[model samples]
Target: MRVDRKIKASYEHAIDNLDKKEENEQLSEDEFLERANLRSDLQDLLKMEEINWKQKSRVKELQEGQSNTKYFHRVANMRNWHNSLSCLAIDGQVVRDGNVIREHISKFYAELYKENVLLRPKLNGLLQYDSLDHSQRDLIEWDFDEEEVIKALRALDGDKSPGPDGFPMLVYKCFWHIFKVDAMAVI
Candidate 1:
């Protein structure tokens, strides 16, 4: 234990010396390279610290039966900086600006919607539907109760893509007691 402490102290002292050396304005080429290497090592240490905290917190979350896959995915995306589009092809030309990318996406989806409008079948039949039996009509138009909503929410996959509200079914399940009334109202 004493030897380990001494070694740690020596390492810290060496780090302090390197820091001082880095701040010297008259550093030689070799010293500059060494300082750059030390800076690189410091950056790596900071990255490792971030990763270590994430891993430890993940272990705690797993112990509590909470999945951290999404959290890890978010962290990985932040580290990789992949959310921004580097380039996109629009109108037979490559565009790299952010605003242009958004416009391209909007125009593309708008054109897709226009194309889909053409694909819709025209209902030419004029009131040619027969009335359903009492039970069949009741089944077709059954009202949803709180219990049914809860059951559907419970059956949903937590990892599935969220709806437009940006909330997964897992959130609904977790906060069901508080939001049940509002959810049933929406239904």
Candidate 2:
């Protein structure tokens, strides 16, 4: 209902000045064009947010399930997958201790990636496609809008693992209104 009201208001504003230019003309033609674009963009964003909310609700319902037993087993399986270690066999022995397993994995990967300083055949055109198309890439590199940043923060799963900073999505979402200006500036 709120979204419908907003859509209606925006539609009226856009249509009111559709063909006739404003007599006061405080805003330039470009500004008027931007206002017209805002109406459509707002409608599109509201629709997308509605759809995302519904999808999230459906996913939560499915995860909870009608039966508690099935939900518990499914969650346990996910936890196992997340915490599973790559069991490695080294020197005809099995190592399972946390530190030893980590060291073994590190050593294996280190040696696996070690470069050989030997003469090798030359390859031509290996760098093809290495450079991005500047024009095409520029399209995606625009600064984030405040609403876009907020939407991204809201979309992050609060239960998911935090990044290197150790701050979870819940923290960001909680303080979004306070930090939104600074966050948008950084973008």
What are the clash counts of all predictions, listed in order?
Answer: 0, 0
List candidate 1 segments past 4 Å from native. Answer: 1-131
lDDT of 1 by residue, 1-187 (tens): 0124454455456667876766775677886677577666655655665676567657766786766566656655565563467899887899999898998899889887776666778888955978899999999899998778778888889878898899887887898898888878888
Model 2 segments more than 4 A misplaced: 1-114, 118-123, 130-134, 163-166
Q: How far in Å is the alpha carbon of 132 misplaced in model 2?
A: 5.3
Q: What RMSD, rounded to one decimal, does every model reach?
A: 19.0, 27.6
What TM-score fits each model? 0.31, 0.31
Worst 10 residues of 2 by lDDT: 66-75
Name the lDDT of candidate 2: 0.69
How high is the CA lDDT of each candidate model? Answer: 0.73, 0.69
Q: Tens digits of per-residue lDDT for model 2 on 51-150?
A: 6545555576677673455544554455466468856667988777878889888988999988876766566866566666998688789677777777
List the lowest-lDDT window of 10 residues for candidate 1: 1-10
Best by lDDT, which number? 1
